[model samples]
Target: MQFENTLSFAKSLDLKDELSDYRSQFHFPKVNNKPVVYFTGNSLGLQPKRTKKFVDEIMADWGDLAVEGHFHASKPWWDYHERLAEPLSHIVGAKKEEVCVMNTLTVNLHLLMVSFYRPTSKRFKILCEEKAFPSDQYMLQSQVRHHGFEPSEALVEVAKRDGEHYWRTEDILAKIEEIGDKLALVLIGGVNYYNGQVFDMQTITRAGKAVGANVGWDLAHAAGNIELELHEWEVDFAAWCSYKYMNSGPGNASGIFVHERHLKNDKLQRFEGWWGTKKDTRFLMKPEFESTHTADSWQLSNPPVLSLAPYLASLEMFDEVGMEKLIKKQKLIVAYLEFVLREIDKETEGSFEIITPADRGCQLSVFLHGQGRKLFDYLMENGVITDWREPNVIRLAPAPFYCSFEDMYRFGQILKSGIER
Candidate 1:
């Protein structure tokens, strides 16, 4: 479908959208006492309006019920963790038994590595992308060093093809074939954080398994922003933070997925904690660790319920919207932004370049030709809020749930002025 420059085209599309009303549910940040054109959801999501109410309910429970809130409340504090699992399962496209929300992203990554990254003499290498997130890189290196293997030698980074903006599927599959036998585990981001490239997790997982290596994903950017099938793809394990598109607030607790295949694999060793114990026998104070058979068995301690209250509210919205529907709208909204931005680029005769691929998610990574930082600063001054990535790139994400066609129009106008200035 093509959109004309005619104003009616944008208005018509907005009128036709079924999920349009959902935008009102969020608390959009303001600049100069007005709502700015926000395109930074890839970094921090706009807060759900209901998040306050969610937190308030729990706060009231804690204050009014005192120590009795654990069992005396309407939604018992004791089972609050269990209430989140069903809604969360739908977000990641997994069964209830396959996912658990606990811990921060990096900590959960380390926990998963402990169980999945068992290195042997011949098969003792970890394969990841060349420029993974700093957190993932640190965890992988530390894990390798712990096993008495040098990071440079034991950790293999499958580099991007020469002169290419992204990692090719065939190149990664070929590398998997070449190193499968010697590989201990494969951990890569479900989406590249900097470039916003959505990786082929299904293909990557299959390729890793063909070589007998366990596959895991860091879905920090991919979780609420993209549709995932962790269980269907047979990913051995995966982890994600909730602050980005999940709208769970800053430094929110994260989640993990473990395939049911590993449920009975007693050979797999996990870092044990009392929270991972079987529910029925957990408080018995038994010496032996009777680990739960599901993904919950990985939990190290009880989670902070106050931090999780927002996720419960946000995930409920996701359950109502459904991932398939959200993705359909996301593709349209992002494509529209690209179309407008590219049309502007064409008008300027290559004043800017969109470094991120057209196939990428809601984010558009743009490189300004000469005045990158100055232009970014000007946009902020003009009430267009975006994030600049170091020396060149500016990331703009037209989040489907809240950002409107008018917001995109306003951003385009501000961006054009910024480029000209």
Candidate 2:
């Protein structure tokens, strides 16, 4: 399993890669007339070539049938969002009835919080990771304020230890225990957007539930990048955006998972609408709200078909490839990327500290010591599409669906040269 910083070695890996051929299925952007080495799938995935066909079908349906397209189109627009549930359930490891496509990531999180984040005099605090994504930070703050509590009093943050880039599992579990009866909810990003760390969700969920708290995950970065068993893990609820790693278009619709136990519960509080009514009687327009008896009950309105069209296209690929094969390639490819980064660091006498820990997915967040923004610009100008965070960390996420081992090799060459320059 030794890796070499050589083109031949990289090509050898590609020759043996079963997923290599799938790379051509996507459309990569060109820089200098060459397809760029894409490392931003954790930010926005490369578009699938098949996406145009899916989108075209929708456009054609709307043109040919107009309003009747809702019932007569190839995939029937009225129940269009339902088509996503089964395949998406497989990706997130949930039952079909427990998952559904709906609003965007933060919107779904807020809706889910309305149901899961019931605070009382005894149990009123929510525990989340410190420095969560800005959207998540805003969502939690607003939710707490809406419930008539100060964020300083109701939000409990588990911060990384001094000099640490990743969160410790023991610290999180201990924090849950410390919160004990006061903990109302534990919602965190399943894969940290900053460091690319995949938290021990199962362990953390168990600890949260044991402490009488509801546990959930924002899987925006975890959903397609890593293996998840949300159902088996007993996660109360979860949500994820489809753009990153999922290869849906930018800012596409999101998917949600509400545990089966909560599916038909009468006590759960959610903002509901007619689309969430049971399908058999939905057109009847009854005054009372009847739950769809699934995660679809969380929908506030009919889906935006244009956005869902691209997502449905992406899920088709996931159904074809399955998560098992994707994760198999992900592990090998990310390991090779780490090796290449180390090799470059040694060759250029550059101090590259990978902040992403062993518990990571496709992303490798490296702290580029003694280097500045010029190195990032050099790589970007040279056709390596990566992401730069504040400070000195650059997130390189070589999505296994399209990226080959040679990308790792070439990126190393770019890094070495950028440092030497």
TM-score, one value per model: 0.97, 0.99
In angstroms, the error of model 2 at 40 is 0.2
Task: Summarize candidate 2's per-residue lDDT along 1-421 as a digit string, tens digits.
Answer: 9888899999999999988888999998999999999999999999999999999999999999999999999999999998999999899999999999998999999999999999998899999999999999999999999999999999999999999999999999999999899999999999999999999999999999998999999999999989999999999999999999999999999999999999989779999999999999999999999998899999989889999999999899999999999999999999999999888888777667899999999889999897879899999999999999999889999999999999899989988888999
Q: At residue 315, what lDDT does model 1 achieve? A: 92
lDDT of 1 by residue, 1-421 (tens): 9865445677788888888898889987788898888888888888999999989988999899987887897667766778788988888989998889899999999999999999988999998998899999999999999988999989989888788768888888888888869988999998888888998899889989989999999999999888898889999999999988888999999999999999877778999899888888887989988868989999988767888899898998998988888788888888888888887787777888877775588888887888768899998888888998877888888888888777776777777777776
Clashing pairs in 1: none
Give Cα-based local distance difference scores for all models: 0.86, 0.94
Query: In model 1, which regions exceed 4 Å deviation?
Result: 6-8
- What's model 2's TM-score? 0.99
